[model samples]
Target chain A: MSIVKRVEANDSWYMPAIFKGLGITFKNMVLNLVGKREMITLNYPEEKYEYSPRFKGSHILTVKKDGSIRCTACMLCATYCPAECITIKAAESEDPTVEKFPISYEIDTLRCVYCGFCEEACPVDAVRMGPEWQMPGINGANFVYDIKQLARRPQLKGGIVSVVDEEERHKAGI
Target chain B: MVSLKQSLKSFLQKLDNKSRSIYFLTQGCCSIEVDNLCSSNYDLQRLGYTIDIDDPREATVLIVSGWINPAFAEKIKEVYSQISGDKAVIAVGACSISKSPYVDENGLKLTDVLPVDIYVPGCPPRPEAIIEAIRLLEKTKENRETSKIIYGAIRELG
Candidate 1:
């Protein structure tokens, strides 16, 4: 059981409390006006809060050094996705070494949960969670990002090269 | 005379922009993020956006957040019809835009009922994205022809 102390309420008791509250408010106002304390509000457009590298904002399809897409159309990402937003149409690759490549890779941005499962499921590091989050559009059609938009959008420059080496993976002999 | 008329029009536009009020429809989890936008951290009021909760008629912008059921669709249409003067509708989050995680076969999309000016795509888009969408809406309102052309060119390039 907790102890309770009885205190008498008086007309004089409220005055000191009111003055103390006002004093604190006035002090804060003066401090803010004089620029003595930093404001918590972020001037959004001018100054953006940088999220960490692991932040799952948007998807980016990585490319090879030769400016080709890195995705091998393994279907692991599509299987793992809870929302099933990713659609990959696999086609036979022309290269003797490579087996298959996605003829069409589309992600319905409006349906995506940004769960980052696709990034983790990829064995080749073909998919990554990019830093960009702003993807507002005027139409529903624009929300469906195709392979070209995912990999070779102007914002990503030419393409983001995968850090993982194919030779290193083969040498590991999984 | 033409220059003077243009100047007066621009002045009126600026005044209209300043007096714009927003009516936000809270439907799901996305409403929480929209609520965050009004707080001191985001401070949407600084951008001349006032949330009008009492009257839909007074709102110049309607922010539709989250999934809309068939029952709410009729109510949304009624509210949309009630809103007077120049109005813009914003669809915030994946649910509002495409009704994600919900089967589309029976889903009632916001776009089918009302024309959307901006589509902010995310499970629950960050407040920054919503702000950017509002800014884009304002820009389009200011110069529709030029902005459309620019936006089209950018889209084509992408």
Candidate 2:
């Protein structure tokens, strides 16, 4: 346990170790300059890196055929949210065919874990995790997206509708 | 005194020379992901945008990211105050835009404290979106300078 290596003159000067480090750096610099080394660095802004097919990002509430929010105010998404960030204030739907509708639906992006549980819990495929990854804001209040904001999201094709929990899918013929 | 056109030309030149030196004020978890913008994949440095963590005074842009509760609000205000008037503020996350679930009635947003130039809304907006927001800001900035020059010239001629 009390073993100690004897220090040499070369170790004190450290010229050889410094040269070795410099040699590796110069080699890399030359290799990179000549395009011999593989370039892993992506030119961002000009270049875009693709995410996985099943990537989950921001939330978007789907619209029906009439362009109205498809949400039936089932409360399944709110119930399933582990973060409890989704708030849906349900009201009686004007249409007699529908039971209830979310008068005010908001998702706190800060608290959202981006877990697809809410999507999976949805029966009507009303809510979706959009492919939009960017969500920068200047104020905190803007993060709490309202019903209009969610409903207004552009329909990104091949987006996640719902996974796992689709009990009512067979009945609805979706 | 310099002529109106000469002053206007110099003003435009000065505005163009101002590099977007950003100072990131990260508060919560979401900022961790936003840090990926500096990595190899979405290298923001290549675009001449630098994050000066040591000094806010030199920064031309302030990127406010993550959740800002009452406590974080005070620190943000201090940082914002340190930055000069000739600067743009970009809010990067939903939490910075509004009070997240963690905050109550006393929670204060970055907007209430400082003027925001751009708002990129997402839970954690992608690096691409952030870049787009900045690009939009740059375009607007140039347009604003051009309009100012024209207005100044018109006033001088009148």
Candidate 3:
């Protein structure tokens, strides 16, 4: 069974096909010049691309209403993280409500895969993927994001409050 | 001594005029973003950066993307040595910078072999991030303060 189509003498003509291709190009050029067509090129320095809310880029540590870190230092995120980029030092909390808290929480951005597993593993809504993707730095030391850099960076503007209710969690005993 | 400063100034001026050629030693998915940089959408050429595929000697900037083993580390050093006059090195993606999930006892980082000027951290950084790294390099070059080490290297070469 021959599925190949035979080329007729009429089909061999090149001029009409060339003209059709050129016409499309001409139309596009005209449309672009007339400002009818949107340019695909994004002037990066002058403009920026906005990723969706779900877009995972950088990691952020959520804070409680009392201006303290929301993380209870359960080490769930560290255990679940495939990259093992997250390092947390668990310490006893002064507050009666919270049993433990991370004395020092650090994430090596260079080692992180950004799988958002940390965010998913977090029971207290402590860790999340932030909207800001720009993480370029000059030195290797700068890539290792500490608690201050992660939770208390000026970009977060005091801190991003978690949706998880602290009182509800306390009642539920999470 | 005055001639040394004069020569260095001339070299910097030459660098400013010439379009920087980049040699990308890619080993992971970050290559996709590097390809995007050359595409019309990103248009790396607009910023006077051309991808050099043939020779490292022609490259002004060396971009190392992904993890490096012991053998790859030696190769990177060789490539770095080949790159001539006031060269800059950029470490792109998580793997190259720190080996990420693939971290092994024997794994070698880009920083171990080369002095990385820009570290663009991402799983696979967007092309925009890479562009920003180049922009930072450009700013540093304009200042002439950071290239003092390169000037010393050039003097040693002579």
Candidate 4:
């Protein structure tokens, strides 16, 4: 039932095909030597490359202007997460202004799909995907970012904001 | 008598020069994407690691990537046992290190089954990050040896 292509005498020899490949290689080598062609290979690690603006890298828990964790512990992110990587344990906050705050919030970086759905699901604008794409770790614990790590992340350049202005307006009862 | 520094230097040099063979044991979906590391773009061969070794016995490092279902536990144990001599295990992806949506409580945890030396975490970790983890593992190995030699030298002096 298998179809087989006929091999010609020249094709069976294989020498001509090899020479053709070699010819292309030599041409490129000569071109490269004379600076006729530019090198495509980048010296990475030493020279960092830029990713697209829309690139969803890692998850960050946004904060209020008063330096308080903004998450209401609604579990919207956990519910929306297709991977079910986000876990939030809600507790009544000591602050009279806020109703609930996450006592323990963890996102297993290994399980996260980086879909930005969590950011979309957050009603309070508490979760946002940051620009910190390099999230590699040597151990399991490193990948599982706790509430402390998530809250302290430096605000990314332009991807998503923590709704700081909106929070301020809410506090002013506007 | 060989000095501690001399022994440390020799050990580091030996580790640096030798090429290592890596055998991948895939258990889940996203981990399959790790094959991209061998593509021309990533070029993991340049790092002196030969991936997907034909013989498990020939491999110096064992990479377990993806989910570990309860049914796959016996297979993991078999492959781990088959690899002869001193070998390091790297658990890649979240499912391997922790329980993902794919596995329940009954599913076997990777750390319980085998002594994992390194972990590369991500839904499917980027190839660059995976490469970085390998380098870090090598560095950690060198550090451990260096410390042991230093302690031995100190004891000899005493």
Candidate 5:
């Protein structure tokens, strides 16, 4: 009775609060055991994971039929990023329809958060994150991944348009 | 830590006692220097000098790869200041030395202030050339440091 009075005097909620604390650690402990290997890594390159149709991984500056970057240099991705980690320079293309091709487009992978905002910000569907997420470099500068590196090497599957003609028909819209 | 210079010199000694510790900075223009540093064929890190982020107190050499954006210019200055004495900054690529027409084409106006110790000229300089530059940086022991312009033959991207 004295304990109850003391509890009321303090105006503290105890049972649920104490149980909630135990439940939090219990959930994390269970997850720790279940996700030990997963915590260490993703089995990339060998076994790539599928992202949502809306998921963003790594940005690839895509090429048209004539083998040119499709980016018009609109600066949409650069403008939208919360981190301001992307850099691109636009140039007029021989094909007027493709007004600007990125004369210089590079991303500091060291600083990029891998948010799909760049992918969504792109109006021309030229830049999207296909599944190549593993950029292992000892130097932070090496982490500055370029457009050519991103585009020439598409490590995952099924995007706007496949660089390989054989897979072109299987592109997202087509 | 002995003097900052001495600590870095010791670090380079660990790579190959004969080699000098280099402060490699590869961000905007010099980013490819990182690629050349890591490519399986080039693998400059295997040669034994570590390349870190903007931190240069641990290093005595700086390699500017790309054009520094306005935002990063101050960071570069801060990095340059943190580096210990008797340091060297290697300006790499056309962008680092002279603003490449290609660089400005994209809306990036970068001014690489002069007095660079070594100028490595190329759109994207080859890894072999970078190795050669490392060798040069290691060999120059003059007390009166001077900016040296180095050029190589045109090469393939690979």
Candidate 6:
């Protein structure tokens, strides 16, 4: 005999759960539709949520005290990049103390996975992930990044902890 | 009167549909290429060029997106060969230009290896520069041929 599905009283089962979820969702939908609550999406260009000081966004090659690229042509970032996106040609500098500089340093933005491992691999704090996140372009070639472009990036005077949304930062202990 | 309006609609439709087609090929290490080329504000089309996925022999632009490996070299060569005679090839990123990293299986010097018509330099180039590159190509060459070729390439990420 086929056991007619035994419906338990305690279990209003799937329908009740679905309705409960629908009710919450419906309430949220109305709330969002009417802007009953404050907005969450940043105004973007006008306003952006704060990110970590170490937030991996744009790449910046920091300079030494002498205003030279901190990279010793170590080839660490180039090797570590899974995308194989970095290009560098090392040259011996005339100043023996400085040693080496990338005669040329280039990154094909089209192919970069943006993993930021290159920044991590650098022994010297030469290349770092900066807070400037806006990066967009067309066709792969236009995305190739240059050293000058990476270096001249505006320093986010907004301190590292400065980016975390004040409200969210209050929520987070860090 | 109906026919005139209909004709005007079709003409307007064609004018609105006018878009440039660009195919990107990856040969070098690719980083930030899309960030530098296709973001909203710096949309390359704003510079009067569109990126399309159609065949290059007729589409007019072919962008080699990354570094060129010997294995992939044959395919890149074929793609260039298949593009229309007036079409141009652009190497967009550094990986496509030089095998900066250690080359075991997935790297090669593309700029030195292939005949690139233009080089858009960047780890990922700025979108503005990318737009500039497209405009430069348009000014430099006129699309003369009109045939389409479709045969090799399009393999999985190796």
Q: A161, model 5: CA deviation in Å?
A: 45
Q: Which ten residues in a row have the lowest lDDT in candidate 2 chain B?
A: B142-151
DockQ of predictions, in order shown: 0.53, 0.36, 0.57, 0.43, 0.04, 0.07
lDDT of 6 by residue, B89-158 (tens): 7666556645543335556766555666666554555444455566666544433222111101111111
Top-TM-score candidate index: 1
Off by over 4 Å in 5: A1-174, B1-19, B28-30, B52-54, B103-114, B144-158
Ten-residue stretch with the least lDDT total in model 6 chain B? B149-158
True contacts kept of each: 0.64, 0.51, 0.68, 0.34, 0.00, 0.03
Worst 10 residues of 5 chain A by lDDT: A132-141
Query: What's the candidate order when arranged by decreasing DockQ?
Result: 3, 1, 4, 2, 6, 5
Candidates 2 and 5 compared by TM-score, better number = 2
Q: Name the Cα RMSD for model 1.
A: 5.9
Candidate 1, residues A38-148: lDDT per residue as tens digits?
A: 898888888898888877888899998888899999999998988889999999988986779999999988889887889989999999989898578775447788998
Each candidate's clash count: 0, 18, 0, 1, 8, 52
**What is each predicted model's overall lDDT from 0 to 1?**
0.82, 0.72, 0.82, 0.71, 0.57, 0.60
DockQ of 2: 0.36
Give the CA lDDT, 0 to 100, for residue A125 in model 4.
80
Badly placed stretches (over 4 Å) of model 2 are A1-7, A34-37, A60-70, A78-117, A135-174, B1-15, B69-71, B143-158
Q: After superposition, how far is residue A49 of candidate 2 from its true place, in Å?
A: 1.6
Q: Cα lDDT for residue A5, model 5? A: 41
Off by over 4 Å in 1: A1-21, B1-10, B102-106, B142-158
On a 0 to 100 scale, what is the lDDT of residue A127 in model 6? 75
Cα misplacement distance, residue A45 of candidate 5 (Å): 32
Candidate 6, which CAPRI tier? incorrect
Q: In candidate 2, residue A122 scores what lDDT? A: 84
Best by DockQ: 3
Docking class of 5: incorrect
- What is the i-RMS of every prediction? 1.5, 3.9, 1.3, 2.6, 13.8, 8.0
lDDT of 5 by residue, B71-158 (tens): 6666667777888755666766545544442323432322344246555544455454466566666655332233121111101111
